[model samples]
Target: MMEFKRKALAIAVMVATSTLTACGGSSSSSDPDPVTPENKAPTAVTLTANTVEENAMGVEVGTLAATDADSGDTHTFTTDNASFVIDGTTLSLAADASFDFEKMASVDVDVTVTDNGGLSHTETLTINVTDLLDYYDFVSEFDAEKSSVSYSGQTARHALIAELKNYIGNGGLQSDVDNGELSSKEEIVAKLNSFYDRDENAWDGFAVTFTDAKQKFFSEISSYKSLKDKVAGNDASGQHALWNGESNEAGQYTGENIAFTGWSTWDDAPAHVPADGVIPQKTPHGLVQQFFSQIADNAMENPGGKRYIHGAEQIEANEIPVFVNYDGTDLNQLIQKFLLMAVTYSQATDDYLDENKGLATDNTGRDKGEKDYTKLEHQFDEGFGYFGAARNYLDYSDNEIAGKVKTEEDGRADWNGKHDTDGDGEIDLFSEFNFGASVNAAKRDRGSEVQTDFTKEAMDAFLAGRKLINDAAGTELTTEQMAELLEYRDAAVLTWEKAIAATVVHYINDLRGDLDKLKAGADDYSFTDLAKHFSEMKGFALGLQFNPYSKITDEQFVEINTLFKDAPVTELSEIDEYQSDLVKARDILQAALEFDADNVENW
Candidate 1:
């Protein structure tokens, strides 16, 4: 320890003590008073460590210390810091301040130390934050159960589609006090229109009600997209791209309304559903609603064809009513599939996950009036909502989600993933229920006899993307971060598209079965069954057009439409050629989607 001292002092004294010695002899008893030393500032300030890992706890980086010029002098420290604190000679991060590697890398603080003499010294230090790039995980990053991940609005629309099917086919209106069968065609038409053009107020009230949470479906608030708002890019322009059935700039189908009456096979297939290019001007929702209204009459109306009538009838043994068009199109099946694709899948992959407009929004701040999430984060959440998977989607299996009952040790059965985990008798629609595409993904996967991980892959990508967005809470995404975001979005969107494609193939297999039953001339197998199978196939095939990132190309979709005709050919003699055409369609479908031949054949 080098000797430390205050500045040296100079003094001049006269020998007046000699002259005063005689007089001082008597007063010389008292010695000269001892002089006191001056105080000085401390130096050599430093911290033990200059780096910390992100999300560190306790934050005891190192002790801060300084050397004092005066011996036996002690020191105290303080800082005007945003993320650090000082206790006596010790240092730590402030309780309120946190280090997120993606959001910030270094914390610069000005630290001051004072000696017991009231003198002080100041120095600056930069604590580098280590980037634990893959630190975030599902359970730790998200609010324990759920946080700001609401998609009830989108789910409600899914529920509405189910209720609409019941309303049209199962006499759902007969049971509800606020709703019932219409007295006249005018009332029926008005009520049907409400399904397509309903606002938030009307939907939650009486338009579509969910008595069960398993009816799970879509995400929400201000800037929140309602089901009606997002269906087929629906807007006031009154020209929904999917409804218009117009080709994009590249001459591809825009995935408008697949509702049409047309040829099973033609050499030159047009852009829209009809071979001659006669596209309907109404929304898909509106067209299906018209079908429902026609069912209410129960009359032998042959508006669109001669073989079939627009009335409720049984398909084989089931008493549940099925509505059919003149052209062997099951109106009820078309309603269920078309709306599910048009609203839930369409909005999830096309609008909310869209690269330019949705993901590029600001993520540094929370939603304008909401604190739960940033604008970008909310949009991602909305996209996931449109996907319609429960937050705990990973916990269930394919059989479980498709409502398969479990085999107990005693050979009895019970529902899996349906029990109330929170101990409440009622279900939580967002976390407990599976809706629309989410349910179909599982059902289609399990139904195929092929193992497909559609639900898990899609949900995992959503979780990863959301984690990235949440981790970068205080700044806009960097170029690398943005690239990562797009990658995850692509994975999720592609998986969703593939699940939809698989379902189309699944229906193709069903349609072939329908063809066999008709040819067998079984009294139990009727054109009614053919109508149901064909409509579902057509509706799901049309879903391929909604996503910009669709794996199915425009040309392939055109081929599919060419293969599907205006209606099923119930004429046994003519049916062979249509069946062959369907085989060709199936070939194109499995090949384009990269599906195994066995899966397509079985599904």
Candidate 2:
């Protein structure tokens, strides 16, 4: 039993036990000397009823009462157990104490009732926690203003990816750097690095910016905790990477000893300047490092190179910025989506949600280290952050989330009263904006006429799971509760994966349309467009291997990758075969995922 704050402290005083006074003439002067009344102790204490519903904080458990012989005695109630406290005769749950019937069915508290006479009586109060099954009612953190759920690191990384993608594809920056508007080659490289590199874990220095009516997103991190040391898995040290070989959970690797062995099928295929070599990476973090350098070195070597590399660019008809390495793959698209999939999706579904990576049995009923959120809460919250939905994600329509909403519809993806939960006038990217998979889910959902509910399903599961964690406050969950948590997690993961697959199919459709335009000798036929579409298609296809729970088999996976050329299909002679291959690959995804034919074609 622990002492609570409301209980009074006892003070010791030396009383004159025997009144020594000159009372020699008392009997002669008065009938008797005034006598003090004897103090009587409280006889017994009882609790009116000791039961409270689960999920209540600081609610009354019962009424504490005492019986005493003296009519003038007023009693003060105190409890030794910190789980409860007494005010007057009412015994209520402690401020930090939340009872979960699933965790603890009952608790015994020792309560002492002290009378004004300085006499006390103690009794054991048994409290029974009643069950509540409304964990599904757990609201969004944004609606609840859950300060404890901190995962700004994930949101910051999402913003960084967006910023970096924008920077590399900027047509103005391309001509300026290539035409000497920027000072030196080293300066260009420095600028590229600055987007991802910042003050040691402070995660600052990106040029990317966003604004709603109320506030601006400057990649703020003052709201986050321990993750400040390291948030994104973009650095080589992170366990996440584009998985290169077979998907094997038991044989995870992250050190120098492993060799980059598996581009086995396309090992001999021609690349613009192969980025291959057994470059000390089996899992491909080293491959990412290689790309990080390759593009920068390409720009540094060629004073007037295209944004990402030194090459004669296949400019797009729409003139959208195209940043690609010499091999014609957009490093921006690949890296951004890669990190989104491997780091964010993998973390939400595979790493944090599972008992293996974290979210252990002991994760509940306490704060995670010095952070305000409990371990279980933080674990899922981090995953949700990486999913990159605004706190009120469901409020926005699909086109609004994809940033493709027309002006007439009054879509509220950006800063508007609809999503400005903070009401600071600007859309706070940390919580009020959508990014990464959440946006992609919206895109895939709206791209096809057959409509999917990927975003809503996943968001609902995340909310419900966190509710489960909340209900079990300050106590480890029972086996049943943990199972329930995992079930919700699985729902979110499955929907998220389906969105990714649909996205792959969506990109494939884009590539096919590009091929058709090229064959028609359409003026808008742009290799840059084809390259962009192909990169997204192949990149997401590559993503299929990252999720540990993915159903994409090795054979189906290899067949899809094998169909994708070393680069986008640039040669006109190959258009027919390449387009055929595109349908084949798309068919494989459609069959494996059981996507509707009309939806795949439309998507």
The residue-by-residue lDDT of candidate 1 on 1-603, one tens digit each, is 223222221111234446566674555367676788888898768888888877675577778989777878888898887678788777888775667665579878788989988899998878898865332223312244545444556656665676677666664443321233455556655655565555545533352244455332322212223445656745322222445455556544455544332223222323445344333335454455456565544322322223223343533343333266656777678767877887777776666788776787888765775556677877788788777776656555677777675565222133353434355665765566677777777877776666778877788788889888888865899999999999999998888887888887777777888888878977667666778888888887866776678877778887887788646777789888998899998888788778877788887
lDDT of 1 at 50: 82
* Highest TM-score model number: 2
Q: Give the Cα error of residue 93 in candidate 2, in Å.
A: 40
All candidates: CA RMSD (Å): 16.7, 19.7
Least accurate 10 contiguous residues by lDDT in model 2? 10-19
Q: Highest lDDT, which number?
A: 1
What value does the lDDT take at residue 215 in candidate 2? 23
- For model 2, the local distance difference test gives 0.65
Whole-model Cα lDDT of every candidate shown, in order: 0.66, 0.65
TM-score per model over all chains: 0.64, 0.64
